[model samples]
Target chain A: MKKLFFYTTLALFFSACNKEEKQNYSNIAIYGHGGAGFESHTNRLPANSFKSIQKAIEVLNADGVEVDLQIDSNGTTWLFHDQFLEGKTSGNDCFGERSTSYIKTCNYNLGGKIFQLQELMDYFSSLSPKPKVSLQVELLDRCIDHSLLIEQLIAIMEVNNAYDWVQIESDSPGLLIQLKAASKHFQTFIRAPDLTSCINLCSENGFDGIIMNNTDVSVKDVERVQALGFKIALFGVASQAEIKSALKKHPNQIQCDNIELLHRIMKQ
Target chain B: MINKGTAFILSLFLFISCPTFGQDSLSSNIKITTHFGYEISNVGCYGNIGGQINYKKFGFGLAYILDYSDANGLDGPFGVATTLSFSPNHSDNKVINHFINLDYRITFHQRFCTFDCSQKYNKIQELNIGYGLSIKIFKRLSISNTINIGWYLEKSLSDRTGKTISESGSNSLINAKLNYLIAK
Candidate 1:
């Protein structure tokens, strides 16, 4: 008789606990982030100046980002995407014009100055809603400098635990392989140059996110890749239609050259 | 012996009081009530009392409830609502009422609140199955008090969140209503 009472009481207690847990899981919202203009453009001011990107992000209610961060010849990191700064900056062809020290004074004609990787970290952490905007630092210069870049970026991320909000991405297979060895704990994206390769690489490396160019990729591609439960990121978006279409597919992030249009598309 | 006697008396009192503790006679009324009463709860609360014109088959109501809390938030939920009630004898005063209701309180659209991970709003629809007593006070006016036990499902819902957030628990509503019949 005592055993019977004990079993019945235990059953009721567990049933109540189960009911409470079910109630807690009913409120999750899966929001998307990113559009074009994440890279390939120069800030007319200090690279640490978050005005353009912040305003661009405001429209999308973006929670994640796949941005381009370039490491200059002098070992300083700034957000840049173009191979040359001729028309983009002050028309000086500043890509190989000067060392990192000299370019710091050149003002890349993008209205902003170059921002150290640390400045980006500080700006992101101070936002009110605190965008979960994960970064996909694109390695532009391939002089085997990713080791140093990873070390610096991870230091900032680890100091703030910003790794939770940022994911490192690179198109180079060699760079990705190096990153895999350097920091097994940090999430990395293998930015596929094409769809066929995206599937092949993502399948092997077990990438947490995929960063792709928006020009060739369609919304269906975003949907297909996202269906695999991997986060989708659209790279190289220059048109409003491309950005809007990818937004419909709800990619995890969109990397683009036009920040103003990306912001407008997000609002629409 | 004395202690045993005292314990016996206490048990006897508890047994007698148990049945009489809860509300007597489950009287459910399918009345379209425009409540001008205080709305107070986590979802939202206000106090704006109103009345309802209810017939045997349908009910229409208008209510303006105000929040007494310092938030000073007020809501005027004015709409026509219909109630389907099951009462065996419509003319009888001491009748038992059972009802299921879908109450839609309209308001400005905003981000929804959810418990845990699932989002749910206050457009709560209740499928209640309980017994209550209906007391007839006047010619066309009657007073009813009831405690209903049921689940509040989403009513007039636009968004379907894969599953129900809260399961059927002790979602019991205690209501005291005076209903007037417009026609038979």
Candidate 2:
């Protein structure tokens, strides 16, 4: 009877080990840009509102997705593209004035205001696939209080336990370096518009990789970056042709407005 | 050169509207496919061996074929072709695959003299859509029964004909393919 019990326990232990192994590996990560920006003109994506964004995230979970974020000058992080809430919101033309109070008072045309950084993080944590998907926060504010913004953002993400699945990024070299130093845990990257600058940034700082417009980059450029043992993050590409072009570059991650298109191009 | 407006519109349609045949996912793997089949034409019947390597949906490959006809005896052509297939994933074998293919073949033909003093021969420039069945023979190979709806544009030089003769037809071909899976 004791031998039987021991054998049963051993079988159960191996079964538990198999379960852990199953969760450790997954190949696909589908990236979705916030609400289908310019990719929608041809993609004809659904409405670009909060509900659509949430739904898009859910659809992305079925295949894995990466969300975008940016911080404002007032030390508040929000889900937005531009640095200012001017023409996008009330057309006030107030650039660099990203205060939540000012943004709240104005009437946004879409009937929904910007999502607070905490609120966005909370939404992801509440999802079924909480940390499987990741985040790429683009530091949009040029004049942000880097230390304060990084502290508060880290506090929020830490509280929600999202640092495990998020990476902080920016277009400014100095800002990205500062943010990385402050966080210490999350990976950091620089978003450059040109390939030469991207290569220089990645090599100079020993960054994880660089994200750039797909059309602006060439295969040789991407190959050079990859040859350096650094990763390549591509963005703003939404078609099969563009994906095929980007693949020649051998990107580490490709962020697109159309996740379906990414899957198609990659599958081939 | 085509007008900018027309080119722009056509490019826009090709860019945004083209749907891939498979599921979209992020996995870095290369697919290698090889095919062998027979071809029949007015000149003769030919056996061909072709292979292709597709990396992230773009294909580069070569084909070598031998032809034997009642009129022409035996002739061979070495051809090279590329495929641009847009799709999400091929996990689910599809019956109709939408793809654009460019094929060039260098073969021997009787050069005819056109009435306009132009040259003509039996050369085909084919742009085709693959519509058919993909059957998995085992784990390593797939046999495809496909019909290609293509535009066959021929350039000829003869006293009675012009420089170019075009025809649209459905060509039936069977492809026996060997597939290697490199990624998920």
Q: Which digits, one per residue and each the tens of the lDDT, describe model 1 over residues A1-268?
A: 5744554455445434422211221121122323223323121222223544443333323344444565656656666555555554553454433367665665545355555556667766766445554454655544426666666665666687765666777776666666666667667777766876877787777667677766667768877887887777665555556655655566666555544344433432
Model 1 clash number = 44
Number of backbone collisions per candidate, in order?
44, 22
Minimum summed lDDT over a 10-residue window in model 1 chain B is located at: B72-81
Instruction: List TM-score per model, in order.
Output: 0.44, 0.46
lDDT of 2 at A123: 61
TM-score of chain A of 2: 0.71
**Model 1: what is its DockQ?**
0.02
Task: Say which candidate scores most in lDDT.
Answer: 2
Q: DockQ of all candidates, in order?
A: 0.02, 0.01
lDDT of each: 0.47, 0.50
